[model samples]
Target: MITTHAAIEDNIKRYKRGELIVPSDFRGKGTENAIKKTLSRLAADGTIKRLGHGLYVLPKKDPLFGEILPSTEEIAIALAKKEKVKIKPAGAFALHKLGLTLQVPTKLVYLTDGNGRIIKVGKNTIRFKSTTPKKMALKGELSGLIILALEELGTDQIDESTKLKLSNLLEKENPIILKQDLKLASAAVHDFILKLILNK
Candidate 1:
């Protein structure tokens, strides 16, 4: 008979390096405590890395960096994929991603069409805020990030320099996709972005 620990270990090995793991992934192999214990044992032996409560990963090895732990963005993307949810970067993080800001935010925030939750991974915190389906309907990568970043800056805060930067970015986006995504934006954002698109 295969022991619970052995069974769980085997299942974990099937995952690719840097793949996230949760106890629920081993549901049928053992009882909840046995599964948790097995995961803890593996993490203790360096076979896997314990990220935080209920999160583990098969650490990827890098030549220079040694252990290649996942970034907050990577973790958020993985969690969204696993949960079958849609997520887009929001707030200060969105601004930073769009080159509107140079500072890196310590806490990462994403708007999701799924339940809102906070996950702490090492020094970083990943926040998923529940949002409407329309907000999640953005089809263009550049357009989505621009909308979120603009929302973070707000109408009053936008200046000539910022508008210039946005205008430059708008040139890189596909006109068709940008036009389609604009329909999903709030009235203020739609009008703001349309003005830029029209001026281009």
Candidate 2:
């Protein structure tokens, strides 16, 4: 007979390996109350952190600090994956990486192909916005970051220095897949950057 604590331990191990397990995963073989109780006990012991009502994750360790680093995206991805929803990091996350925005956004947003929701992980909020999967995927990781930056910075904000730096970085990274698409979408900024690069 598998005890509730034993089951919880097994689930925890699975979660550490990047598997998302829900209460039903264990309840299918045991009493729902037993599984819930065990989960609660594990959460209280810090073996798992409860993201929201039913979402949970095994805390990831920070190698440098030897402590758990709180990240809303990681939890959100785990939850979305378990729920069979497709999600891609977007908005501020992409913008910050693109150097178009200097501010670190408090909320981690993602474009998804399912219902949107706000998930609370610790004190951080993860937001999901429903969008076509093609659009979500087309915004390659770096392109998405650039788009976010451009959105925040606006077209006129692409000054000479910033344009040169961005162009150089993009060239180095060879983000050709998104170059034409992003340029077409951001005509003003694209022309400005092109002129600056030519003049330099």
Q: How would you encode candidate 1's per-residue C-alpha lDDT over 48-126 as one tens digit per residue?
A: 9999888999999999999988887888899899889988998789878888889878899999999999999888899
Candidate 2 has an lDDT of: 0.64
TM-score of 2: 0.65
User: Candidate 1, 52: how far from true, in Å?
Assistant: 1.6
| Per-model TM-score versus the true fold | 0.88, 0.65
- The clash numbers for all candidates, in the given order, read 0, 2
> Which runs in model 1 stand beyond 4 Å of their true positions?
198-200
Worst 10 residues of 1 by lDDT: 148-157
